[model samples]
Target: MPGNYVVVVVLSSLAALVLLLPPLFAAVDDGMRSGGKCTNSCGNVGFEYPFGVEDGCYRGGGFNLTCNHTYQSPRLFLGDGSVQVLDISVPHGWALINNTGMVFNSTETRVVLNRTWDQLVGGPYSLSGSNKIALVGCNARVDLRARVKVKHGGRGGDDDTGSNLISSCTAVCPLDLEDMTPVFAIGSGGSSAACSGVGCCQADINLDIPSSYTIQIHNLQELGGSISPTDLVFISKEEFSYTNDMAFGNNIPQALPALLDWYISSDPSECTYESAPDCLSANSFCHAYDLGYKCHCSDGYQGNPYIRGGCHDIDECKSPQDYSCYGNCNNTPGSHICDCPRGYERNASTPNGCKDIDECGHRETYQCYGECINFPGGFDCLCYHGTDGDPRKEGGCLPVKHHLSARDLGLFIGLGVGSGTILLLIAVGAPFLSRKMKDRMRIAVEVARALTYLHSAATVPLIAKVSDFGASRYVPINQTEVTNAVQGTIGYLDPEYYYTGHLMDKSDVFSFGVLVIELLTRKRPTYRTDQGDSLVLHFASLLRQGQLVGILDPQVLTEGGGEVMEVALLAGMCTRMTGQDRPTMREVEMGLENLRVSKKLASHDTASSSLVSQMAEHRMIATGDMEESSIQYSMEK
Candidate 1:
């Protein structure tokens, strides 16, 4: 009862294991037999469909097997009792069977041993290519002859030869003939006991077996005066080793292990691209072998392809060693998708299927104009070397200037005075401006030095003629120049210059203010609303209402940020009705410079909480300078 219980448990466990396997491999087609439950095992070997012990259980007569109960233990044989089956590998389409060595006496010049196929004749079985013929004798040469099945390229099908010699080997005693002993017994040096042409030899079958073969042993030299020693030959698996019993041709095994190839169908062209009825399992296909056709599961599926729905999708995600996925793995019907995690990207070169994105390395997308420090998933674009501002924009990172300079004052003066001012002001103010105008004042100074030398060439105290003389009017720093008539571009003309009939430096400053409004709003000086109001008037009204951003260019709002608003406010001060009410060009430039410095300091504050606290007091002083010095238009004349 205990043994029965153990058997029940083992059977149940095996069933469960089969169920857990992919449908293609389930039970190895064990349950495919019809007419009541068929026996799946005989002795220790278990088999499946296409091979059975009873009628209606196997595919055909060729697949029928017999379980012999006459012995103490049950033994499985092919059809009747000729060959005993040891193991059957359904997936590999091979079977391990027992074979016997042939023994014959040779007195004449040659002796021949022949065996015919019986139980396995006309069946889907043949001695596999993995078997070799071995001969054990002295002073004899053995040769194997068989009818091998050869497939024809044309429609003629297979061509079976009448008799073809496949392989041959010779054996001889390496000692005196009178000794009448094997090579090992003679203690000959450099002679091995293995099947190496000394007393024993081996040869490959080298061709497909057709259930029958012949072995001819020719006695090269007779060892005795009459009958020679018995010669033994074995057609066994290629892995079989020769021993003393085989060398002396005695105590030979009744059954030596040999591999036999098997197939599902004898039809060579049954499984073509268009049709494969023999492969009944879903997700399975038929492939042709040298002799017949075999069924195999399609890619990503496994199991017995010879049975209906016996092939199931392989869970590739479960086997990481075989189907590797480094990130979030999603298994599908016949395949799987591996998606990298957030902030990561797929990399074919990496085994993990993903690699971290170097955000800093991609400057175009990340836009870091400063020191870029890369980390896992993300990166830091800190203002490098004490410079401060957003590193994510053009000219966003800027050098930290502690004090306003005369050049900075002059640049903004130009910005508020002419169309060229914006370029000149930005040259010294921020990197967002034109690179051509950077250090414009310095370049002008150099040109002036060169001109000074040019003027020295004039004999009459270097009388220098200034270009664009019409654009210049003599006016003292403290006084304005009176003109006979008001003449200027309509949109850029100074109102006070026409009323006072005078050309003052403030006239140029007024025109510069119009240019600033043009830059910020992306509107021409002549641009006007349906109400016939100029861009300057509309801009000034919006600035007074603290709605300066409403009319600002969208691009300026994005790139300029808070700096745009400060620039708009400065433009308003320059366009004031009274020339004296508007700050001087020098004061305007200084204010713009102060705004740049403030912006830089603000960026520095964001680096760390400790730094923010440390710079808080200085930031207030900088902010106070911007408010008091930059846009605080003085009314004093």
Candidate 2:
């Protein structure tokens, strides 16, 4: 009996899992009919739902597993030799799977893994959601296409709210591939060990799974290069640790019960035509699938409507615990009712509805709290002294004037005036504020110079005249404690900079990117959590896909087509992490001159702007100073 109950529980669990299907399940059209004898078994594993060996068994398509009986024990396998699944986990959304003996060497510092969609050889489904693409190697670069779900765009973090986004994470590390080392961080990097480039990598999936996946591992020294051939790529169903040993470079995830979903796209005409009465009762709704429509009782009812017998009504009154009632509960055939207790009069409108009798008017049932008021729904509990009328929301009402009379107020004002005089006297000699202001001005000038010099004179003239001169030279904002919350202009802040307050021209480049976006479209570099769109991100996405015209500012697009593309590419270069990689205003000028001299550019030139000229001067000073400082430091060391 215990075993029988266990079997039933197991069956129920499996049944519940089949409810959510993948997008590909749009192909299935029929229910399965297994005549009698169960066929193959791998030890304790039984072939079922999606793993049957023959046709007319699986409920959908794209799930094919082969039972290898070549050895004494039978083993399940995917087509060819992609992954070897070890076990299936229903409670925890994972499958114990691993890749075969392919290895990759970590000659470079990074490797890549992918969470790809697979159609188990025309069986009946595809796996999805938060699947981990594990790259067991050192120095990994995991580039992923984390797209938004087609249906919904974002994920809600709280328990009650809906989700907002399907996200992906990438991890990296550097270690000895043959040492079996965990590849933890070597020293101190600002990033945590979780993703601090020591060894492991992970990415989050947006809500929807794409049709397929593209994967590549790049060498930081140069792109489109690979490490030695000892590393292995695996899409794990669970978390996996990296080993520094030679084997780890080649260890892939073990294949097992990878979870996939099946969907009934439309109502099945076959099932509906074959069993009209039994399939869909008067009270039921028809769900058309690829094969045929399956029948079920109406929303409020449950039972076997697929059989000859009629679907029975569910009695909500059978158990008082079934329905949510505020007071006395009464049962009906398909629903329940509630009634208030004795002294409370029955309310005709709401269920379990009741109103308290006005006993205070009769001077009987309630006690007093300052004063009592009799109302239709209930009695009011009035309170005094730091209280309000409603005991729940506003505790009680207060009688004003227990502290601070007019005399006390006047005395405090006199004290404040005395303190103000003393502070003003100190302010007369305070050099700290002035010093700080000078430092801020100094930093601002440096930044202004970097920005100006990097701009092309022909495209954006470097004007020396300061019109919007919000910044002053030789004055330091550092003198004051108040800081810059957002240092760069909207378009130019680096996307890579977050959580830290470090400021420099690189951050300004991020802002410049925003400016480029503005030049392309009329939008600013603003982010709305409610609406998932960023001007910079939108433009960057277009550029990455080589869709320049789609994002180019219409006005600019009409003026110059080919020139716009070159400028966009230049803007991208300016945002590079290495500030040295950015072109100096002079270099930018030479590049621009090439186009103008070639007559491929517009005749008008705005490159000699004074602002840009000032920027060029500032850069000349700072870059020379920094380079000399670094060289001296190296010599001293």
Candidate 3:
């Protein structure tokens, strides 16, 4: 029994060790438990967790730094020996690198720079979007090209090679010194101090640059020959604005500060709570970045995410200015609360939290017209109705102007009499006007339908060319030949055709539109008001001002509902300035047909619903009578 118990204890110990070994090994491998043994600095440059110069200090090779002490001061570099790392920012995962210089041709007329794709492959660095390509010359042309290999399935399986992508920009100098004066000022030695196309131009690189790319500059041939031979072209990380003249004197810096994006190389799918590498810090999480994963501290916490117990909660109340809490602030684990005192409210636009309520804003709460005074936590209204005086003073408002003046009394009487006269006229003439409008609308519809058939369905299609007679003549099908001269009446003729002497189907459509407007207003096209305004012009003006409702006949508005609005819109479209803007006869016919169909379906649905409701009422009434009779018969028996 003793031997069996010993064997059981040994097996249990082995199981426990097996269960605990993974996390222990992971913590050591990720440098979280390294206890600051790693070299954290190279010269003046400092390093954070996950980045170090020695083994067992960094998460992986991409995070490794090479400290070169060849110069007077030690310098840091990436895996690529040629690229010197200037600075590393852990919070933003960005690294500033001094890029290589551009190569100028022997003639200095052309400049070229090449970047290889292999530099970024399997590396933690990628090109960022904040880079710009600049060309400094009076007339310069720049061409950027890249050769990208396309993978068939996004994985590194089958691939298509040598797809060239190209982008180009051209900058031209002003015609003369006078033309350049507004953009750039001439300095003491006749030098311009602007880079905004007067002598230099810059364009942003909107798309991501492939690992392998080439930038080429060419001298643009202009009327005054090629630009200055001292021209230069290069890529920059910072945006360029017209500040100083750097184009002529070759003052542009050779190396520009360029940003490189960095991320962890670990796969997100393989990361787990028990096996996460360098991501075991409290209050931190892992997220996918580019082709791998990166670690981030949780919301309300900030610290080095790769170290154990690194993330800490932020006490927002301690920094009132940062959080814009002007009132009493209460601190929480990761946030704060700002509370306003009694009778005060929060100010949405100000950093100060509480403000006195503007009682005048709430008109119903304090109905005062003279004055509304606001205090620190409250407000007061100081005027009474039907009085005028200084509201801030006590008993300020007193009764005044209670009696009406002679002019006021006269105005009131005039308004009443005018209103009564207008109402009386409307009451007496409404029925007669209604009858006349119905007749006009019927005639207009018939005319429109006839025109639609003549233009689209007749054996010999008709075209309206006569001006005096309201008649149309037949023309051969699909015959769009222009007539010799315009032969239409002066008032109704399409202005375009009248001046150009060109006849088209749209000419007729224009005349029909005018007729529709005439019918709606119950007025002749030649009719004018006392102001001598033509009916057609007046109708167009009202429509343009969105006053169609005001100008529409009262009878038409009463009976037509939305249909009148649609017709009015159609009329406006047909009478557009250009004949080509008019709708074809077939389209006009279809529009009217659709409107008729919709109206018929709506009417049928309403009738069916009414019938059903009537039948239901009758059934209820009959059932009631039957029940009464049954009860009466039972009593008699």
Candidate 4:
């Protein structure tokens, strides 16, 4: 009877336990469901709404994550089973995955690794910016090839073509350890940490992996007897450091983190609002990525953008640590504002968002030399220009020293003599400099105008292709003719005429451009250094590189003012690669004539102003003399 009672009690307890379990099971099941309300986590890694572990949990097939709990810890795998998922970010539209190790050949002389995107077809995943091909070892060479298969015809068609992109990188050890000593000194554990022309080298993988890509390493030569046969050449998402100990470690983890960019739409044409994926939430925008489309939350909002109503307004003012504000912080709907207090000001480089006004710092406004009293909004100066001493000290203003010793008087006389000499030199040299500048300008304008007239205005238009002023030929308009085979000066000869024996009006334009350059630079046309580089070529190169200032004559630049730039630009345009591109001689003449007229007008205006000033000064002196004479007459009477 006692045993029967115990059994009844156990049965009653089991029934109570069953009744309590249903609510708990329902709550757990709801948490695992997909969409915005679902729990988005696998083991220690956290994923967003677009990436989930179960069916109907993720946005699409490409974003699916398979949770394998058979191991000691749960592991999330990509749908293709080629990579293990590490982390996913909705804002960046990227996921971090683990890299696979390289496979060594039977002879150990070569290693190969591959990344395939076959399972990602018609999906939104692609290898993005975070990956790079790394080659590590002495005298290691890497051959990287990216191959993608494209369907040529319509659906179900057998037409297909493979496009391949090939590139290579080589890394070699230095001839001497001393050459690498500096690099080793700054590196951690005396390892060559940088991938720049050392035992390790890296090249960026810019192309997306659509079908497959391969990285093969060959020509692995040993450096010294200590070189390990386990040299690694692998694709890395994160940068790797090369150390001597890594070569000796058993089963070293070659897996590295790689970045994958994801999109919402499989077909690019369907990226429009009417055909967009249902996962894209409100306040989100779509962008083209690789062959598909990606969704991003608008600015000022941050959350799971692929979920309905997931993105929320960011309260910037509430998080003062994230937003910068010095005085008053005001938060708007999508942005924030920083304003200065009453006594402060705002500047481009204002520290901590606002700068306090220092009224005494501005000598022109406060005008204080001895003492300055500062208030909340304004300040007052105790002493001004005549006073001498520190501003903050009491009774600081004192009479300036006026008495002079014999040495001070001698110094004053020496300074006066020096100043007078400077004034005399300026007064004498200024006119000479001015005259020299005007003469150069006038000569340049006259030469250009003469060339223009010969090419266009004369009864028989002449092409002055020859360097000598005496040599010339007549050519009428609306005619294409070949000139007699004659060689002119080396640098001045037109390249087209020299090659094809054809001469045109543009041939003279080329010569004129060379002449202008020579005049500006004050150098001979055929001038060459020991390197056999001619001045014409040098000048052209300088102009092309925007270093015309370096080759310009110092005197011309100082005196020509803005006209120098105009002349340089005109010369550059005239020296075109082909005759058709060069400006006509008539155009050149008009440019020079305009520059000359402007210069003459400016000089005339300056002279007139100087004459007016002299006349005014003389009239004031004459009026004072008359007043003095009147006063003298009154005294005599």
Which number leads on TM-score?
A: 1
- The regions of model 3 sitting more than 4 angstroms off are 1-35, 70-73, 104-117, 145-158, 162-168, 173-192, 207-210, 218-228, 241-249, 266-278, 289-292, 341-350, 355-637
- Model 1 bad stretches (over 4 Å): 1-36, 68-74, 101-106, 118-120, 148-161, 176-192, 223-229, 249-251, 323-330, 336-357, 365-372, 376-637
Model 3, span 351-417: residue lDDT tens: 6657767776764555555445455676655443345565555566776653333233223222332
Superposed by TM-score, candidate 1 places the C-alpha of residue 1 at a distance from the truth, in angstroms, of 62
Candidate 1 lDDT tens digits, 513-583: 66567667767667777766677777765665567677876556656766665566667666767677565
Q: Which ten residues in a row have the lowest lDDT in candidate 1?
A: 1-10
Q: TM-scores of the models, in the given order?
A: 0.49, 0.31, 0.44, 0.44
Write the residue-wise lDDT of candidate 4 on 1-637 in tens digits: 0000000000011111122111111121223333546546768888865666555555554566667777688887665344577788878777776766534333333333333333334446666645676665555577666566566677787746564655567766544566532121124544545666565666777766642444455655432323333445656576755564333343445466777776665556656763365435677777665567767777878776666676677787787567665556687766777677765678312446556578768755555554444445565555433345555455666655533332332233223322212221222222122233445555455555556666656655666563433335556676644476755666666676666777777777777777677667777666775555566666655654557787787767767787776676566556555677566766666666666677465443442343334333423453342233222112111
Clashing pairs in 1: 23-310, 24-302, 24-303, 24-304, 24-310, 24-311, 25-303, 414-421, 415-421, 416-512
Which candidate tops lDDT? 1
Q: Which lDDT tens digits does candidate 2 get at residues 154-260?
A: 68533332223343333344345897433444434333334323455555442323323334454332244333323334443455444444223233233312343
Looking at model 3, report the run of 10 residues with the lowest lDDT sum: 1-10
State the displacement of the C-alpha of residue 244, model 2, in Å, after optimal TM-score superposition: 7.5
